[model samples]
Target: MTETVLAEVLAELAELDDPKARAVNERHGDDHGVNLGKLRAVAKRLKTQQDLAVQLWQTDDTAARLLALLVCRPRAYDRGDLDLMLRQARAPKVHDWLVNYVVKKSPHAEELRRAWFADPDPVVASAGWALTTERVAKKAAGLDLVGLLDVIEAGMATAPDRLQWAMNHCLAQIGIEHPEHRTRAIAIGERLGVLRDYPTQPGCTSPFAPIWITEMVARQGAAVGRANASPGR
Candidate 1:
């Protein structure tokens, strides 16, 4: 059944392959060339097929692995399984999906995040920080906001690029969600120059920590004001 599923997925992927999309993926460091739209479509078709997902992942094809992320059972993945996936993931895009779509949704997310944070491998550490950002964004009640800020302040400047990106996001989330931390987060952003010069697309908020925090805070305030002005608020 897994082989049959894999064959169908590969056939669909081949039929949907676009040279332009493959080139773009390659340029972005995804060597296992595949069009993203087709990959997602394949995943949609194979959704919830855990055994097939594992088989696809073992193939190590970029598109297949992405499909695996969509179909694989997160509850079935233990720390060892996640570790193996992270080690096998060489592309930043792949790592991002694995963390956000797979590990973050797993029961072992917190356990893996704590362990991965201390890992020497940058990819693993990046995943840890990514999970941390999700936790902070959702306002997880037990997170030590001050300790998180301290870590960001102490290591952000010297962190690897991917880890730094996630750390900066965590800092921004803190400023956005916790009004009291807004000023400090902005100060940290200024000190570290996090994504200071990143080129943002038109009509999009800058991802620079200071700008992002300020924008998010303003948006939140506007939302609150709207809520208060409503008839039943």
Candidate 2:
């Protein structure tokens, strides 16, 4: 990939909550790699900010180094290379980006999510969150709701809290996307007892209150009834 523009880099940096880390990534992101160094120079001169660049040059945080790899030119890193980088880096921002960006788009999304589940590191856990949100939402059409529920059920058996958050995010998105699958989701929720732990919200009174699957099931049932009542009767 060609060097990203200073403006684009700045926009992405802004998403980061930490100003210093964002500034460092923006200013020195291009300086480390051979091919990317030229791009960084151009961005540096264009922005006229050398202090942050110099500081980035001196710091030795593995997170910074890992962020530089993704920001400077992600295409250059082989899939296998990310493992080595992850081993050395533990910054939350970098971990979130890897979860949100790299793993979501990689072929190993499932494995990455599983790793995040297995690892105790918050950064990795957050990446697991990202993997579940982005990948599942994007591929909702192709997923088998029954199979997915089974997987999530199995995951919840091993790690309920972590996978529960992930399931909630994914299921909510899926409910929105495939309104027809609400019944199946409600069944899954019942099987997993998601509603038991997180009781339905009181005021909404929607079937899917504490759990969205309830609302989805109600809607789907209505639709199915309508379909059944339609022609031949």
Candidate 3:
């Protein structure tokens, strides 16, 4: 089944220059065109197939490689194929690809979460941001909230001003996602220190607000925690 999917993808890749193919590709390429129309067609045909994913994984073009990464769902992941994609995904856009798809979709949440912590690229770092935002909010029992927190800790420990700014943005995102656990974020603010904390910098786009601003988060979470601690209310 995988091989058959691969064959079809290869066939498409081979005929990329054919007028019929060009027309189809053009239709897909136009930003003004509806993506659903194209996506539906692709999905229906590729529902059970997996080869189109493989060819794109193997493609030499950085854009094509990133596109393939974006197209494949996290659930469809073949570890070997993902390993290859990560290895070949040297371009910045590829990291962005992982950020938007794997992190945001987060189908295989845990493995991809680990990747965000380990990957050094800014784009991959953004995945860490997404995970922090998505998981910390729910406070899922099995998800490694502590491990994700460690990424922020490491970022604060080593970050220079520029990198610190970006890392802080990620921390802020975590806070927004988990307003229920603002105390967990206090460490992030404390570690980040006085430099442009997110709380004080009202206009700043960075998500990592100063710990003080987390007052709202703290208040909300505290109320919930207190309520939960109480008997039946």
Candidate 4:
């Protein structure tokens, strides 16, 4: 039954593949060509199935694994399971979706975060920073926000593209959420000049920390203004 199910799912994924879609994904370092929207739709239809998810993940097909991430019971995997999955998922999209969709919701997130944070591998370390970025925007208690900024300032400019982007995200989140750290965050961004010249589509915000910080803060302030101006009171 498991073999049959896996075969069926793989067939369905193959049916969804598009040459143009693959071209676009290839540019981003993801080899699979299945449209993401269709993949999500399939997952929605299949719903959560831990056994099936594990089988899909074992196949190591990028599209299958992405679907597995969507259908899996996130908290079911133990620490070691997630660790293996992260290491095996080297494709950019696979790596990103695994981290964002599955690992982030797993019970071992904090444990894995600490382990991955200082891993010699920049790709692994980027996952750690991604976890930290979530904390910066959400919980943030017990975090040495200053220390995070210090590390980012020291390394982000020299970090690999993926790791640098993750670090930049954390920096922007800290500036946007914490009033006290805003100045240093902006200053660090300005000094390093990382992502400073990154091209952005018109009407989209640049990922450069200083500009990102300013824009996000302004948006939040504007939100507050509109909320206060509402007639609820």
| Best prediction by lDDT | 4
* Per-prediction TM-score: 0.93, 0.46, 0.49, 0.98
Candidate No. with top TM-score: 4
Candidate 1 residue pairs in clash (backbone atoms < 3 Å): none
- lDDT tens readout by residue for model 2, 1-233: 11244335444433433555446655543222223344344444445333333232234443334334344333334556555555544443444455554555566667766676546754456456556556556755554666665655566434544345556556555555565765555555566655465544566533332256555556778998999999996
Clash count, predicted structure 3: 8
Cα lDDT listed for each candidate: 0.84, 0.50, 0.54, 0.94
Q: How high is the lDDT of residue 112 in model 2? A: 61
Per-residue lDDT tens digits for candidate 4, residues 60-178, read 78999999999999999999999988889899888998899988998899999999999999999999999999989899999999999999989999999999999999999999999
**Model 3 CA deviation exceeding 4 Å by range:** 1-50, 103-107, 115-132, 142-151, 157-170, 179-187, 190-204, 211-233
Q: What is the lDDT of candidate 2?
A: 0.50
- Output the lDDT of residue 69, model 1: 88
Q: State the displacement of the C-alpha of residue 52, model 3, in Å, after optimal TM-score superposition.
A: 3.5
Cα displacement (Å) at residue 46, model 3 = 11
Clashing residue pairs in candidate 2 are 200-210, 201-210, 208-214, 208-215
lDDT per residue as tens, model 3, 1-233: 66665566545544443455445535434211213344345545555333455565676654335446545666677545454555555554455455556545545555666665556665444555555455554655676556656767766656543345545655665655655545666666776563543344564343446543465466678988999999977
Error of 3 at 104 (Å): 5.0
Q: Rank the candidates by TM-score, best first.
A: 4, 1, 3, 2
